[model samples]
Target: VDIEVVQETGSTNADLMSRLPLLQRPVLRVAVHQTAGRGRAGRPWLTVPGGMLTFSLAWHLPQAPQNLLGLPLAIGVALAECLNTLNQNVQLKWPNDILRDGKKLAGILLESAAASEGGTWIVAGIGLNLQVSDELEAQVGRALADAPWLAQMDRNLLLAQLLNALASALQQFAGHGFSAFLPRWNALHAYANQSVHILDHGQILHAGIALGVDLLGCLVLQTEQGQVNVLAGDVSLRPA
Candidate 1:
């Protein structure tokens, strides 16, 4: 595991993706601040220096899975598992959001590219709000959430734990796919078995009862018409 910490960067995901061709092994890149952070659907992710955990890990996969769609959900499960050990009781919003008490505590972004020689390289980026300042809350126009224990824990220690958990989870996923993690992920799903609204591009797509996720990690929604498997895309889910 190669690790690099920089004072600032545009986006750790972008940086790692750009270097994947030359990377001989997995690399973890952490930045003190990200000037241009990104989120799902090209949304901007804002961060304050020293107040958030922003990092990316680049790993090479010898053979890409047939369905790479579940990778982000797998990563979310890894994060929840790590945070649960710290007694945070974190929950996962479908696909990749991490929540604490139903509020956003962290987010994940995954990007992959074909390797120069062979195989595929994936970059997984995570942004966790350790402490939400008043200014940040105001900028976001809402109260954001953080892991309370982060104030007492050393950043490096927390990072180490997260990486360890992630490595283990990734290994399992590579070997067995997302099936092994389905049950655990559903147990931690924030909207499991609840009536929820699914939106795509700001328009209502479906209102249905959450039936957890399928083997492929797609959200299975029991709608009036039928059961719909919702894939992660330009979509959002909220309580109905």
Candidate 2:
């Protein structure tokens, strides 16, 4: 893994994609500051200078397993483990959101290519608010809140820990797929025992939450009626 710490870049993921085609060799690029970052649903991620950890990791998984449907959930577990070393109580929200104290502390975005030949190259991007100011907070709106625990923390050290954890998760996922990591994913899940509303395809699935992710990393919802397995989508917490 090669890290390229730049002052600023227009969407680290975009930058890597642009250069990947021209490079003779395969490599990973990590942009410390992504000026135009983004998230799921093509929403812009506010990446202002100071106190925010933003980076994109590009890797070519040659022998990637086809059943890596729970890769994102596994990444959440890795992030929780990394943050635990910093003494933070972190939990994973479905689809790839990192929560601390019921607020978003970090997020992971994974994008995969069909592979021009055969193998798949994935770009796993991560963003975190280490110490956002009030001015920036106002710009962020209700999407996120200030994380005080991030204050006075070492960004480099945190990044290193998170990368290491993610690397470990990727290795395990590539080898044993979802089955090897589902238990850890369930343990770090924030809404495992709570009621949640699943929003997908203009339909809402209201059900009681069961522990652990299905093969596709979906939230296993055990409603009053029966057990229903939900695949990836947006979910809102309903009062239990």
Candidate 3:
């Protein structure tokens, strides 16, 4: 994999997407500052120079997988698993949010584009809070978790470990879809067996206990109507 270190970029995901036509192998873009970073549901990603570490990795496959929706969840599992060993407090929020001590620590965004060379290209963008600064918390208007360990650690070694974990997960996903990661994802679920609410556009859709996820990687909620499988989209999950 080729690594491109940039002091700043408008958006690493967009940068890698534009380079997909010329892509032949995996590529990783590390941006110290993203002037126009974006999160899931088109939310603006707030960042401060030296206070956060943001990067996006691009991988190409000959074809798209059957369970494409599960890709982000699988990545979440991989991230939580990788960080859990170093910091037991690391947890995974459904879909693709990485939490620490019950607070948001990192967000993952996965975007895919068709390659001109006849394949599929995926760019996984990650934004992680490196320091719990008052300014950052104020900008987000929410409590956030910081990875002080990551702040003090060598970035190169940290990147190597994260990338390796991602590589292994992606390789496994390519072979088995999401069934292989369902159990792992549930094991690290931040809201496992907890009362949760499924919402769409701020309207409650279902209120129930999170029963982890099914084999197909859909969120299984134990509601009064019995088990309900929720698909990922603009839907949001929160504590009830």
lDDT of each: 0.89, 0.73, 0.87
lDDT of 1 at 127: 96
Residue-level lDDT tens digits of model 2 in 134-218: 6766786754545566556676776778888988888888888888677787888877777776665445656576655787787
Greater lDDT among 1 and 3 belongs to 1
- Sorting all predicted structures by TM-score, with the top scorer first, yields 1, 3, 2
Give the 10-residue window scoring lowest on summed lDDT in candidate 2: 20-29
User: TM-score for each prediction?
Assistant: 0.96, 0.87, 0.95
The candidate 3 region of ten consecutive residues with least summed lDDT is: 112-121
Best by lDDT: 1
In model 3, the number of clashes is: 0
Q: Provide the RMSD of all predictions against the true structure, rounded to 1 decimal.
A: 1.2, 2.6, 1.3
Which pairs of residues collide in model 1? none
For candidate 3, write residues 1-240 as lDDT tens digits. Answer: 998999988889889988888887899999888998998878899887777788999988787887688998898888878888777889888878999988999999999988777668899998888877788789888899998888888887777788889889999999989988988888888999999998899999889999898766678999999999998787888898
**How many angstroms is residue 28 displaced in model 2 relative to the true structure, after the best TM-score fit?**
3.7
lDDT of 1 by residue, 1-240 (tens): 888999999999989977878899889999988988899877888877778889999999999987788889999998898898897669999878999888889999999999887888999999999878888888877778876587579989999999999999999999989988899899999998899999888789999999999988789999999999998778989889
TM-score of 3: 0.95
Return the candidate ranking by lDDT, descending: 1, 3, 2
